[model samples]
Target chain A: MSALLELSSVTRRFGGLRAVSDVTLSVPQGEVLGLIGPNGAGKTTLVNVITGVHPASAGKVRFAGEDITRVRPYQAARRGIARTFQIVQPFPGMTVLENVAAAAMFAGGLSYGQRARDEALQHLRFVGLAEVANSNAAALTLAMRKRLEFAKGLAMRPKLLLLDEVNAGLNAAEVDQALELIRAIAARGVTVLIIEHLMKVVLSLCSRIAVLHHGELIAAGAPQAIIEDPRVIQAYLGKRYARAQAGAHG
Target chain B: MKRDASIALVLFALVALLPLSGEAYWMRLGTTMLMYGVLAMSWNFIGGMAGYPSFAVAAFFGLGAYAGAVAQKFGVPMGFAWVGAGLLALVFAALLGVALLRLRGHYFAIASLVVAEVLRELVNSMTGLTGGGMGLNLPIPAMASVDAQARFFFYVMLLLAAVTFTAMLITANSKLGFGLRCIQQNESAADMLGVDTTFYKVSAFMLSGVFVGVAGAVYASWVYYIEPPDVFDVLYSVKAIVMVLLGGAGSMFGPLVGAAAFLSLEELVWRNYLEVHTGVLGLMIVLLVLFLPKGLISLSQRLGRRGKLR
Candidate 1:
């Protein structure tokens, strides 16, 4: 399958600091790609570069064969790139259904009113948030807010969905439910690039894994091979831990 | 939306009967009230709906008053001049919003607040066109009598206020309004949801300016004279904001209710406490905002709830 998203030598700098440097990666159509890195590995910055929240300081980004290197955030969304913030961002004054319906109408190319609301309801059901559809989004609990993010992302009818630490604050059972929802989303042929710290989720749900260390792509391959890679282990668990793992495996 | 529209229609119909009283004093008060309603309703578009604290109302108002005055000076028809003022305000706001809306919150407020001062200076310097700080004079309309002129201007202001109210009702129910509410609540999320934030902000700003500009032109025509400090006074901006806050920000009837309440207070205070009216009015507004931050709409709703309990 052809790559749905291609980043060539993407670099993002905040003044003098290169937050994301020389990172080149791609996700093929319908692939569930896990992006794992240690803290300050620039994972979120890389996603920002992709979504044009912070346009790459250098390099090109191609989405579905079209160059979208300098598109605005709204344009990126309308072009079928949907993202959830690392910290959930909901329109607090709006109802949960209104939030998703806004996504459907604006980015999903559906008309506002009944059609958007109906589509939003379907996404809400998929995320198991149908019960609180009419409640103010601010009233939702953290887990529910995370699920609201998923419903919002789905309502955008995205070709590429970037889940930014959706499981970060979630508990074990909530994580399992999220994992199931993600698998269902992937089954529907949507490409996902999920940033996660959870090794279990990375190992089980992702067909392919990419590692970033100090703003560079350290490794990319099948999840099993990636977990055992010396550099990936070193980057995540330090050089001493990598040696310990190597000794145990040897 | 339907209920609000019908209520507004009946209210306007009753207000339209003011001329039947045959009292010039009442006519003057009613006209001034309607004009205030226009200013307040216009401010609601950007300040209340879009969550942008704009202090550029005086800039648009002064620009419109001058645009109409200057156009009339050059022999343009009265109706065409008012329309020209509205269009000029729309264009000016569109350009201004692109630059000003980039700044959010306090920064945006301060930036917009300077616009009126800058415009006042510009009008002050342009001696030949604007007659400088000496003030400009508008030609008296060729009406049969002074009473006829007063009645005509009163009806004109009434019409402008009604149009502004209708526009607000339409906007509050439209996709544009929904996007604005989203922008107000969470701008970044709205942007990621494919709302063109800049576009929406500029549209709201334009909506806030167009009607106020027309009303300004009407005021200039009604008064027959306008000076830079008189038309471009920063008080216009402050009063618009106060009126919205008084009634209820972002509510359908808030601006109108606030305008009526505010004007009545102004008239009453000015009558009884002419020496200290400004000080008293300022203190009263501070108290109103402090005690009823949600505005009179919430208070009425609270009262209605209590009645239901009874």
Candidate 2:
């Protein structure tokens, strides 16, 4: 499969410290790519750079064979790239359905009232939120809010979706449900780049996984192989500690 | 069953009967109430819907008044002068909105105030066109006797208020209004959802300014005078904002209710304790902000819920 998104030597600097340094990765079309990292490993920053929230200090981002390095967030969204924040953001005063409909009106040319409502309902149903269509988003539980965030992203009808910590704060059952939803979305031929902290979710969903430590990608491969690799293990611990833990555990 | 028609019917009844119940002084007060209602509703377009607090209404209102004054000075007909003032206000608002709507929250509010102050100072410094600090006086047109003038002004203000309120209702039900609400609730989320936030914000600001400017023009004509201090008074902007907040910032009838309540209080205070009216008005606003931040509309909503349970 062709690469849907390619990031080469992408670097983001906050003053003297680099948030994401010398990172290179590619996501294949119709595939789920998991990005796992420790806290402050630049996962969210990478997503921000790709979505044009923060300009990459040094790198090129090619999405579906087009250079979108300098595109604004709204422009990138219009170009079929959609993203959800790690902290789920919803229009608090609006009903869940109206929140989705606003996206449909902007992403598609569904300017008419009935058309926007219909398309919004379809997206909400797809995300299993059709039942709470009239409920104010402010009243939704955290899990439902995460689902609504997903629904909002889907409403944009993006060719590529970037999800940041969609499973954070979710119970095990909720996480399993989210994982299933991600799998289903990928099965529909939408390219997904997911940043997650749960190792089980990353292992189960990603066809390939990239490991980041201190703003650098230390390893990338099949999930099992990457998990067993020495460099990846060493990156997670100091070299001596890795040897000690491996010896003791083995 | 639509809320718009129900509200419209109530407004129509009130407008039709208000002329019959009062002396000339009370009718004059009625005209003032309608003017404030128009200004409040206009402020609602940007402040309530778009979640952008604009404090430059005095600038647009003053601009409209000045336009009318200039037209009248050039021997233009009274009717043409009013139209010219409104159009001029619209143009000025569009230009100003483009520049200031880019700012968010406190920045936008302060920018609007600065614009008003700048306009006031510029008008005060210009002696040739505006007659400078001395102000301009117009020869009262012979359209009506003194009593007739009061009645005509009341009706004119009523008609303008009706048009503005109707426009707001239509906007609240439209795509533009939905976009604005989204922007207000979560601007970045709205962008991800495909809303052009800047466009909607600027459009709302301009629409709000046009209505306010038209109200100022009518006010100047009704009072038969125009001056920099009176036309560009910062208190008018505060009154509009207070009216919107006291009624309910984001609801259709909130501003109207707020205006009525505010005007009644002002009248009582002026009549009973004229010397301390300003201090009392300030105290009332401070109290309202602290205790009823959601405004009278929310209070009524809570009451209706309790009534249902009982």
Candidate 3:
């Protein structure tokens, strides 16, 4: 199948440092691709580049065969690309549903305020947050806040959704619930490129995994093959050392 | 929301009936109160809804006055002159909003303040058209008497206030209002969610300017005089902002409530202790900000919730 999103030699630079460099990747339509990496792997920056928060320094980004390297953030959203921030940035003063409805206003060719709110309610229900729809976004717990972010991104009705560490800070049960939500989202035929830290989620949730190390794609394959790759092991040496420390104490 | 709209409709009708009472002094105060209330409501579009904290109200107000007066002097009909003034202010505001709305928070507030002051200085220097520091006297269109003239301008301001109120209500549920509230809470997130922040901000700026400008036009014609310091007074912007804040910035009825309370307090202070009128107003604002951070509307909402609970 043709890719829904294709990045060709994309590079992002912050002054002297290369945050993302020559990263060419693609996600086929109706696929779940997990992006796994250590700290400062430029995973978030790569998503930023795709979502138009940061301009690409080199190369091009294509969505469904159209060049979108210079697209503005709102234009990217309007063109059916949506992203969630690693740090949840809900509209603090607005109710949780209003936050979702605000994003939903631009969905499916500009719905009226009431219709948009109605559509947003469906996304909130999908994320299991209909109960706290009237509560201010700031009052949500961390897990609920992540669900809110998920609902907001989904409200855009995106063909491609980029999730940034959505499973972070969740308890074991919450993580399982989130994985189910992600699975349900992908089942709707939407392409998903998710950045995740949890190896358990990376293995089970994603059909294919891409590993980034120091702004470069170290490996891209099935989850089991990526886990078995020595390059992936060497790239995660710091993580291995930390794991070794935990093991010795136990 | 329904309660707020009903209250607004009642207010519109009652204010429209004010001139019928035939009490000239009370009618005049009523006109001033409604005029200032419109300013508060107009300012709320930017400061309250969009969270821009703009001080460009005085600049547009002054520009509108000058445009209307100049048009009137050049043989435009008196009513049409106000429209000319509104259009002039609208164009100026769109340009200024584009340039100045880039700054956020305190920087934006201070920048807008300086822009108004600059417009004031520019108006002062253009003596030939504006009559400069000497000021310009408007030729009161052949009204029957002083009361008649007062009645004419009173009706005009009353119309502007009603329009502004209706506009506020419409905007409260409109997509623009939703976008603006999003921008106010988190601009970047709003942008990511497909809100054109720049367009929403500038549109609010222009919308705020049009009403305030028309109000200035009406005020100029009412007094039959215009001056740099008087028309472009920073206090006009300050009072408008304070009224919005005191009432509850985003709530539909907040501006009217704020304007009524503020105007009554001002009149009381001005009548009893004219010398310290400003000092008392300043103190009241300080206390209001400290005690009621979300303004008087929050208090009413809390009370209403208790009533429902009971």
Please state the interface RMSD for every predicted structure, separated by commas: 0.7, 1.4, 1.1
How would the candidate models be sorted by DockQ, starting from the highest? 1, 3, 2
Following a full C-alpha superposition, what root-mean-square deviation does model 2 have from the true structure? 2.8
RMSD, one per candidate, in order: 1.7, 2.8, 2.7
Instruction: Find the 10 residues in a row with the least total lDDT in model 1 chain A.
Output: A237-246
Q: Point out the higher-scoring one by TM-score: 1 or 3.
A: 1
Clashing pairs in 2: none
Give the per-residue lDDT digits (tens) of candidate 1, residues A103-201.
998899886579899999999999999999999999999999999999999999999999999999999999999999999999999999999999889
Order the candidates by lDDT, highest first: 1, 3, 2
Candidates 2 and 3, the one with greater lDDT = 3
Give the Cα-based TM-score of candidate 1 against the true structure. 0.97
Q: After superposition, which runs of candidate 2 have C-alpha atoms over 4 Å from their true positions?
A: A237-250
Q: What is the lDDT of residue B185 in candidate 3?
A: 92
Candidate 1 vs 3: which has more lDDT: 1
Alpha-carbon lDDT, every model: 0.94, 0.85, 0.88
Model 1 clashes, total count? 0
Candidate 2 per-residue lDDT, tens place, A1-250, comes to 8988999999999999899999999888888888887789899999989988897999999899999888877778888888888999988888999888877778655784888888889888888899999999999999999999888788788889999999999999999989888888888888998998777888789889898889999988898687778877766535674566468669
